[model samples]
Target chain A: MSAVTYETEALTGRDFPERAREELRDSQLRGNIRKATTTIRAKTAEVTGELPDWQDLRRAGQAIKREAMRDLARNLEALEANVSRAGGKVHWARDAAEARWIITNLAQAAGAEMVIKVKSMTTDEIGLNPALAAAGIRPIETDLADMIVQLGHDTPSHILVPAIHKNRAEIREIFMRAMGLDHLGDQPTELTAAARRYLRERFLSAEVAISGGNFGIADTGTICVLESEGNGRMCLSLPRVLITLLGIEKVLPRFEDLEVFLQLLPRASTGERMNPYTNLWTGVREGDGPQEFHLVLLDNGRSRILADPVARETLHCIRCSRCLNVCPVYERTGGHAYNSMYQGPIGAILTPQLRGFAEAGSLPYASTLCGACFEACPVRINIPQILIHLRGEVVREKQATLGGRLGAENLAMQGALAMFEYPALMGLAQRLGRVGQKAVERDGRIDWLPPGLSGWTASRDMPALPPQSFRAWWRSRRGRP
Target chain B: MSGAREAILGSVRRATERMPTGVVELPGYRRALGLDPAALLDRFAERLKDYDVTVLRVPEAQIATTASARIAERGIRTLLIPPEFPEAWRPSGPTLVPDSGQGARELNEIGGVMAGCCVGIAESGTIVLDAGPGQGRRALTLLPDYFLCVVLARQVVGLLPEAMPRLRPAIDAGRPLTFVSGPSATADIELNRVRGVHGPRTLDVILAG
Candidate 1:
């Protein structure tokens, strides 16, 4: 009944920083990014502004997800068992490769040539389209934004708003380029019309549809996909064979949990009190929706995640993308900077936890600790706390790989650790620092630093060491040891 | 409901037991919001505006005939209405399709009419649509181009959670349940708000006196 997609990523290791950096420096991208995110933020705020108890719903949302995580295994098993029992097939994947193999096999077995895909980050994470392309099955994104990204051959920049990196003008260009319109107008309505026209034929025609669930309810054995577009409907309904690739973590405990999320997600994502659409289905019906349903439950490192008790809750993310909208770094650099299927604060916390910082490379440092993501999060995930946790993992990973850190920083940390662990040694070290303070002192702070530490010192001045040891001060002030 | 659901259904049954029914009273949702009995209509009007649902406040006497004329005027056919759509409010020309069940009754074409269980959370512009007595079948609200919901002065609440207690009995009975906010829309197409995707394109609300 229970299926896992990713047991591990089997990454080539943390060695691809340079390749990712070049893609992050596009001026057109920066301008497009700023305009797109700001506008969505404003629109969501406007929509969510109409409701009260948003805060309560957010708290409720957080509680529900917490409950889901606490009982993930049971829920996932139930969901898988139910789908299987309902005459639907269930596929378990260990990672993207496994998932692609399972899906490609299914497609080939079904003799399908073209694929219509609903908006799914899991599919993107697994590189499903490219895999399908290589296998001679063309995968077309059905979600309007996803289709826009597909047509343009561009990686999605935002979580919910994938095309957020491209403005109306850029879209006009993408539309003209992809849809082959020579004189496409640069207005929102016009562009939207063109895109809608282009995709309408695909919607009514696509024989196979692939999707992701917002929540996979374990109890009723249901899959929930909350979207604003009717394209999900077409992808879901028109297709004779429907294949869904969902994360193992998307399962919830009960139907009632959906109530809390139904209220929480739209408000958090686009700031709407309630989403315009929420579709929940058990299994394939006699004459409704897709006749044949296949659910590929992906672990893709989730079991590895489950093994790590400290970071597994990162699995409970609802993909609301609310955190991204409010993220300061995500706003400036945009999604491409994070360089993963996920972006922004939730991505910062969840990605590093799922993929690990060693292979993820520098993503752990991609946060300002502003706590906006935590505040905006519907599930109330303390993103900063997780970011800090991942940073610790990153440091541990660095130390393990570097083998005792031949660098001075490791020597300092080891020396400090030894001193801190032993009180008398700590006192001597602090006293020594008090005497050494004059070397780096400038107005009670260290303004200049070395190369490795320059990134830190660029935005921060290290506070001057205490003039007198803290133990000495505490002893004097307390008149005791 | 027949196959391969033993474990999942058992788990569902177990989970429902944990939902802790009667946690809060339903009727109290209206009272807790603290509205004077007479001022209920004002609260609903405020909520209508707050939820971004357009409201057409008209006297009960003028409701059906006026509403029917409005729909006809707009040149829309295929009206999907809840089971309890008032006999007086039936419009002319449009075929009133009711309770076609899930998936079979997709709100793709035509428009719909539903009864609002309660309207609250003015800041979020949300309406709680429980497929209970008057709210009609779930499809009545979902599968339509334009949705016209009738919110009587009495059936308005400030938040969805407040309606949970009142809605539980129906849920326990395995009755249909649907919670809606704003018109059916998606912003994914180039991040532009396009109304009437799968649900109603336009949602017009009627606050009947």
Candidate 2:
């Protein structure tokens, strides 16, 4: 059997802690993220609260996704057959490398010098832009936020709003520098108009366009792409050839399921009743949309994730990104700290699993276990539970190595277990801790700690140990009575 | 490539071997807003207005006059009209260009496009275009700066679920669908929404009975 290859480009060079430490220093990024998250959170609450059956809709979505994952192989085969029957070619990719190669070859075969792109996280996961650029095909991002990120040579920091880290002023600078404008205002109207003018010509002449699937119906061979701007429509309509890169897990059993998701997604993701446009095409239409269509089914470690029963629910995400807005850690540190295209609470669990624990093991520990992400999830994914589950997997993998068995953390945990087993030993340790903490104590809190224990105190203050242990206090009180 | 397909399917089968499988029933929640037909139309118009789209309610006979007035008001001179578009609703003054697989550049040069819709959802204030008789192709309404869609009162539904059954026939016929809730918009700049981007910036909907 050939070994499975996990996604590589989505992994980060540095661990989450190190990346977070650097991100915390940028007060401007912090301010921008806080404001954006706050605005989106309010909007989502207002719109979601309007639905009397919102909870029922979420539950139905969860059940449907669970069933889809359970019968994934059969559904995928069905999807392929239906798409082919409707005149669309279906390609299967085991991993990112294969997907990229297939897409690059297709673009080359079509003699495309430039290809327009709709905003897609799947393409970013496989690192498609660099592959296309290497093949000498210019890929133009037509989404306003994606264009801002591409023009500035920056990675996306948020799922819904890729340029969430940048305010209008920064966007203005990036647009002016990239578009070669002498003067550009920072107002959103001016910036959007500039993008429309810049991308209109590209859309008119592009031969090929690429997008990520929001949902692919297995029964009818329908592919859905939902967006706020008309960029998605332009790409889906104008291009002669349309290529959609869909994860294997994005398939739904029936077309009517859109009723549940269409209601949930827009409200949860962008806090709108409905986005400006949603494009759905089955395959090649004679004179309407793309004459040639290709659907690339990408596994890229999704099957490996599905193997584990506890963590498999991660596949149920609709990319609504409400979790990112509600998460305390994501709000304070921003998405750059997560070091993956899938950021915030979802990223913490998803990246580690998709890229393997060895490459992204530190991501599971990036959260505060706040439980906000679980409540905010549209499909009812138990994210905090999955975080704990992934953390166990990370620890178990580490313990398999000799270095991990004898590591400082393992020894400390063993020693603490022994101390807790004996009351006298526990008392002695508490007294010693009280004495040791006095040196770093300030205003009844430990503001600093020695190197081994400093990780906790770096971002927070630990309350000073009480004068007497709780056990001792209870004993003394009983004696006095 | 076939080997990759087999490998992926094999792994998925192995991964899900232990998981339980059964029929997952969809919820039985109410599909409609439970409003009268008049209220549904009012709700639809209100929702569209929230997105800053201009909405006009006209009698069936006055659709042409109202649409023509809207076109002249917006100063649209040249219009792209699908051949299947109802002759009764065709405006008088503008030079109507029939859709003949026009390139994007040519479509952009035209002032606006007018079409009929398949269904309208009041809950989301959305209209679905299924390349049906009068709707023409997807690009006809997409590239132009202005779009005027005529939605008969009978076409409006109370909710998304209600609209689904109406769209199934179009799906079975292999037609492409576009759902437009409003004009093109973006909130990418610090979550401040600015309408008008790649799609038509100005949207006028004639709600006729």
lDDT of 1 by residue, A96-133 (tens): 78889989888877788888888899887787887887
Docking model 1 quality class: incorrect
Distance from true location, Cα of B73 in model 2, Å: 0.6
Give the Cα-based TM-score of candidate 1 against the true structure: 0.78
lDDT of 2 at A152: 86
Per-residue lDDT, model 2, residue A416, is 95
Displacement of residue A351 (Cα, Å) in model 2 is: 0.9
* Residue-level lDDT for A205 in candidate 2: 90
Question: What C-alpha lDDT values do all the predictions have?
Answer: 0.67, 0.91
Query: Which pairs in model 2 have colliding backbones?
Result: none
Cα lDDT for residue A190, candidate 2:
97
| lDDT, residue A85, model 1 | 68
By summed lDDT, the worst window of 10 consecutive residues in model 1 chain A runs over: A1-10
What are the candidates' individual DockQ scores? 0.20, 0.87
Q: After superposition, which runs of candidate 2 have C-alpha atoms over 4 Å from their true positions? A: A1-13, A420-448, A461-481
What is the DockQ (computed on Cα atoms) for candidate 2?
0.87
